[model samples]
Target: MIRLYTKNAVLLAVVAAASYELAAEFGPWPALLTCAAAAAAASAAGAFLLRTSGVGRVTWRNRLAGYLIPWGWRLNRGKLWPIPVVSWAVWTAVCGAAVLLRPAPDQPALGTRAALLAAWVIDAAALVYLLGTLARATPGGRVGPIWKLVAVIAGVISASVGLYVGGQTTAALVVGGGPPVVVGGGFGLLLLFVVTVGRNTRWN
Candidate 1:
């Protein structure tokens, strides 16, 4: 459990940093669009990975116990809908919001900044949620070196590009320069390191 949490946390940091870097590089609007594309591709790729990794046989009834319990009282577990479907829907909505709400390249309006911030916060939360589901979906789900390579490449490139664009364009209005790159890049590297350290995890 500790290992899984650590891994997902690092993954979140990587995605956040990458999003900031990409934002800075491309500006918020473009970055978000790029992220929308990358995320879409990544989601497809992730599904494939889960199948290849032999962990994709997940249904809401079987999968919910692994992730949804963490939310505690906020979610009425008994009444909640299928998590896999809901999770994907949430990802889509968040991406849509990113596409729609990301501010322009120049100094944006206060409302734009506020809306962008809200979008990012929701994105981060969704990312963490999905990561948890991914982590718990497998049993002795040690992936191959090739998959690790994919994770590293995908994580870094997507994140750096995503964060760079996000930071420069949308988040810049709120968080400013230099810090975004530093934080994003730093966390990205940390994420890579964490992925390497736990290349193989088995709860048994």
Candidate 2:
């Protein structure tokens, strides 16, 4: 669909911009290389999991298709919207805290900070829009209440710890603490997505 592509384009643009800004701290080449390696590693891990899960070939193909071709996946719009919106908000909050708490001399100019905040807001909005659209195309289903509650609690705890660490020691927050929270949030989202979409999926 034109609308889906447009939304994805917007989301990707925002992500690219955010990544570019983040990469400024490290050189672009190193950042690009790191991202490439991470992507490859993730792909390999995903492939290994799929291969070892004892699923039929068709089921494995469907799962791989869902991941590789997200637009084709049947997603419940109502359930999908909130996930990205909330995830992006939490990520932004954590990164925002780091920006705010940076040493005075290392702090970005006011204009830069404002621009970053604006970009983050746009990124979140775009992600919600895109995922929400996908959700609308697919039939809806109920995710277990337990999973929802767990996600909420995990998000809150991660945000609290990230904020506290950022305030106490920005170095530790950036170098050690921040990554785990982000990674945890990512895995949580992935699990939530699997639970929500996988349940209603009909494998060939």
Candidate 3:
């Protein structure tokens, strides 16, 4: 649909802007390389997540088929609620924390900080639209054992990395690297698991 394409386009634009801002901290060549790597990583990750989550696979398949045949692609809005909700929530929290807690001397310009905040707002809007689409697609669904296992494994790895990083940078942990890692890797994964898997539900 036009709306789906519009929302996706907006999200992509924001992501590109953010990527440029982040990568531009380095020189021109490094920025170009970073952007290229980020694009590739994002595409691969998106495909993997879509396949693993069992959502949006049909859309991609249809698009691929359209490329080979004469018929236009039928875009079925998939159950993409969790993807934007989880990813944007984690990204906003982690990035916001990093920006706020960055050392005073190394803080980004006010304009850059403002732009980042604006991007988060746009992401929030996109998330709302995706959730609405998902709700219309399906009333509800249960998380399966495989996803729960995946969540647990991801959570454990995140917590372990957070602890290790926190230990290594004890002095700057509170001010610099610590908060983002804790908020992102520690609390983010916990929140994600709880929301997706539920608190009282049995893992098995």
Candidate 4:
């Protein structure tokens, strides 16, 4: 289960990186569309691969749940700073990429792509690591698989949008002069974060 979660996290991280890269090339809206299409394609390919790999026919719902970091809120309530830390780390990486990958005056080149991708991978790993850590620390009060899957799917989308907004905003502010309309996605991302933490935190 841990391995599965890690793999999915890695994949999502790749998705985030790729989406941001696309955003750098195209604009945010078009980059988002391309990401959606890519996600659909990747999901289809994943389904087919799982079906044929003798790994047992895992439903898409379960697969998505597997990708999410399970929140053992009750078990780890006292040590919850890590979640925010993970999120902060992601933002920090974005900041670094913005400055480090800032395009030149002539035209955007390929030199910064590798650095951005590396930063994205670190961001993804931080998220997955936090989830894995919490799951390992706590073994109780888990949400239902269906709910978990739903929460994670929404969270991933929100995260991706947030990343796009951050990446684009940084590029615009520091490097290029892109749009600053990240409020829609930023608000959604914050809301989802609250939802995930609040819903998973066991009060009993």
Among the numbered candidates, top TM-score falls to: 1
The lDDT ranking, best first, is 1, 4, 2, 3
RMSD, candidate 3, Å: 15.2
Q: Score each candidate by Cα lDDT.
A: 0.47, 0.46, 0.44, 0.46
Which ten contiguous residues of candidate 1 have the minimum total lDDT?
67-76
Worst 10 residues of 4 by lDDT: 172-181
Tens digit of per-residue lDDT, candidate 1, span 1-204: 798567545544455456556666677667666665665554444444433443446655333333322231122243333343443444444444444334454655746554444535434454444454454445666645535544543454344336536554443333332333566789999898769875665546
RMSD to the true structure for each prediction, in A, is: 15.1, 15.7, 15.2, 15.2
Better of 1 and 3 by TM-score: 1
- What TM-score, over all chains together, does every model reach? 0.34, 0.27, 0.26, 0.33
The worst-scoring run of ten residues by lDDT in candidate 3 lies at: 66-75
Give the alpha carbon lDDT tens digit for every residue of 29-84 in model 3: 45555555554454445545555543435666444322222111111244433443
In model 2, which runs have C-alpha deviations exceeding 4 angstroms?
A: 1-26, 55-122, 125-129, 135-204
Candidates by TM-score, descending order:
1, 4, 2, 3
State residue 12's C-alpha deviation in candidate 3, in Å: 2.9
What is the C-alpha lDDT profile of model 2 across 44-161, one tens digit per residue?
A: 4444544456555656654553342233123333343333234334334434433343335455454544443343333333344444444464355453553454455455444544
Which should have the higher TM-score, number 1 or number 2? 1
| lDDT, candidate 3, at 148 | 55
